[model samples]
Target: MPNAEKLRSAARLQYKRAVLWSHARRGDLVCRLMLHEHLADPYPLYEGIRAEGPVYRSRAGVQAVTAHELCGQVLRDSAFGRRNEDAGTAEPAADGPPAAADAPAGGGNASFLDGEVADHMRWRRLVAPAFRTRKIAEYRHRTEEVAHRLLDAALDRGGDFDLVTDFASPLPITVISELLGITDVDVDRFAHYGLVTGRAIDGVRSVRQATEFREAAGELDAMFTALVRRRRDEPGDDLVSDLLRPQGDERLPEQEIIGTCQLLLTAGFETTTNLVSNAVLRLLSDREQWEALVADPKLAPAVAEESLRYDPPVQYSIRVVRDTLHLGGVTLPSGTVLMLVLGAANRDPDVFPDPHRFDITRPDAGQHLAFLSGAHYCVGAPLARMEADVALSVLAERLPELRRAGRLRRRPTAALRGLLNLPVSSGR
Candidate 1:
C-alpha cells in the first residue's frame, strides 16, 4: 500500500482502538471483550451484557444479543446479513489487516461467507459436496488413524506433552492437509498459519501483529495458488481437485477456488484443534466427566457436542441489519451492526438448563449455535465433529490416565476461544 493509504489505515486503527478502550473503561461489556485482559474469561462479561437484557446496546453503538432465541432468530433472518462494502460497521482492525489493498487479483480477499445471499449460496453449493455426510464418513477412518498416530508419538515422548502442540493441533492440520492434497506438508508452518489467521479473527492488536497477519495471509494465498495450479494439471482425490472438477455451467473462479482452499485449511485446522483441546481441558478439570468418557469411549460424540455447546471454539459472530427490524424490544435501523454472542447464547439457561455446567450427557447439546445457523452455517461442521469425535475417542482409549501437566495458556483473542498451549501427561 502507498504511504498515504498506510497512514490513513493506521490512523483509523488507532482511532478505533481508542474508542473501544474508552468504552471498555466506561464499563461497556461488549467493548471490554475487545481488551486483552478479558480474553481469558469473557463469559462473566457475556453475563453482564445479558444482565442489560437480551439486546444490550454498547456505547460504541453496536447491539449485542445473548439470548439463544434472539441470536438464532437473527442468524436465520434474511433481514440481517453479513457485512458488505457499504455497511456502516467497519471490519475490526484487530480482526485482521484490510483486505482491499492486500487482496490478490479477481475478487480480492473477500470471503464468500461474507458475500451477499445469492453469491454466498452459489459458492456454498459448489463446495458443499466435499463436506457432505458421505464424504465425512470416508474421512473418518483417516482421522482416527491420524489421531492415534499423534497419541502414539506423544506417548513415546513420555513424561509430559503439550497436547495442543503434540496432538490437538497437528491432528486437524494433517487431516486437512491430506484432504486438500497438500503432499509437501510442513506441519509447523501450517500450525503457525492457523495461529496467525485464527487470531486475526479478533483483529490485529498492533502494527507488528498486522504485519505478521499480512505475511501469513500472503504466504497462505501463494501456497494455495500453487496448489490450485498443480491440481488443475494433475487432478487427484482431494477437495481442491473436487472443486476444480468441471461443473458444466457452474464453476468457481480461480481466485475463489484458492480462497476456498485457504479458508478450509485455516478454519478446519483451527476449529477442530480448539474443540479437542477445550473438551479435554473441561473433561479433565472435572474428573467425573473424564472418567465417564474413559469408561465409555462411545460417549466421545456426546463429549464433542457438549464441548461445542459449553465452550465453543468460535465465541461470537457479527451481522449487519439489511432491513429495518424490531428485535429484542428494540428497533434497529438498516446498516446497524449486531454482535451475536454465540458462547453466551449456547449457555442460555432457557436453552440449556444448568448452562454453565459441562455435562456431556446434555440431550440438547446439539441445539447450540456454535456452527451458527441459516445460510451461513459452517459447511465444515461434519468434518470438525468427526475429527473431534475420533480425537477424543482415541485419546480416551489410549490414555485414560491423561491429566493436565501444567497451567493452560489461552490464545489472546476474543473472537476465537482456544488454548495456545495445553500441557498433558499420561499419568501412568
Candidate 2:
C-alpha cells in the first residue's frame, strides 16, 4: 500500500512537470523559470513576465509579480501571507508548477518560510530581540575578526583557492555557530546540512533530495533540542540562551525555541555566504568596479548594498493571497500565490534608472527590497550587511589584485543565487 502511494505521488509530480514543460515550450514566462537552462540567467524571463503586465497568471494557476512597486505592495500588504503547513498551502511549490511530492511546504512553523500568522508573529517577536540594533552592533567586531582570520588562512594557502569554500562560506558558518553558542563545531557536517537545506528553498527535485532534507532537519533538531535543554539548566550569553530565557513568568514553548534557533542557524549563514560571494563575483567581473573598491576599501558597505540591488542572493519571494485583493490592475482571488520576483523588481527601470548597470555609488541602492519589506522583512538583514561589509573591505585591502583564476559556477537552485565555486588568485 505504501509503495503504491509513493508511486502515485511520483507519477503526479511527473505529470505536473510535463504540463509545465509543455507550457514553457509554448512561451509561458513563469514556466520557463523552472527550466534548468534558464535558471542561470532568469532576468530575461522576469522582464518578459513584467512586459506582459504587472501581474501574470501562470498556466500552473499562480500569479507572478515582477514590477517593483507591485511586488513591494504585495509583500507589505497584510491581506497576503506565507502559506505554511498549518494552512495546507505547502501542497506544492506555488512559485511555479508543482514540485516533487516531498518538496517542503511554504513557510510556517517548519522554518519561517510560510507558517501560520499568529505563530509566525510570536516566533518573530521571540527571536527579534536577539537581532536588535544593539545586539547586532555587539557582533560587528567579532564579524570583522572572523573575516580577517578567514582571509589570513586563504592567503597562506597560496596559489588559487575557491573564494566560496575558503573565505565566503566559512566566515558565516563560524560566526553563526558561535552566536548560537554551539560548542565543538563540526564545520564539514554543518556546512553540508546547510547546503542541502538551503537548496530546499528552491523545492526538492527528487526523492533522494527529500530524504536528505529529512535527515538534515532531524540532525539539526536533535542538536538544538539538546542545546536548549542545556541552556535551560546552565544558560550562556548566546542567542540560544537568550531565547530560552523566560518571558515574565512563563517560558517560550519548546517548538518555538527550536524553530527560532533553526531559522537563525540556516538563514544567518546561507544568505550572507551568497552576499559576500555575489559581491566579490560582481566586483571581479567588472575591472573598474574592482579597482574602485581597491581604491577605497572603505566603500565596502556601498559595494554590499549595490550587490544586493544588482544581483541579490535571494532572487524572489512567494506570497499567498488571503483575501480577494485588487492589485496591479487585476483582481486576484483568495488563495492565489504571487511569486514576487525580487531580482527583477530590484532592476525595475521605473524605480531604478539604468537598472542593469552595477554602480557601487548609486545613492539609492539602499532602497532595493533585497532584504524584503514589511512584517516579514528578514530579521538578519543587519547581521548580513555587517558581515558582508567587513568581508568585502578586508578582501579589497588585503588582496587588491584579486582576480578570477578559473570559470565561476553558480548554485543549481534557482531561488538562491550564489556561486558554487569561485576560483580566484591574489595576483601574487
For 228-262, candidate 1 gives per-residue lDDT tens digits of 99999999999899888867788888888887788
Clashes of each: 3, 5
lDDT per residue as tens, model 2, 195-261: 7866776655555665676678778888888998998899999988887877676566776677667
TM-score of 2: 0.93
Which residue pairs show collisions in model 2? 107-113, 107-114, 107-115, 108-114, 108-115
In model 1, what is the error at residue 42, expressed in angstroms?
A: 1.3
Q: Quickly count the clashes in candidate 2.
A: 5
lDDT of each: 0.82, 0.78
Number of clashes found in candidate 1: 3
Off by over 4 Å in 1: 1-12, 87-107
Model 2 spans > 4 angstroms off: 1-6, 84-86, 89-113
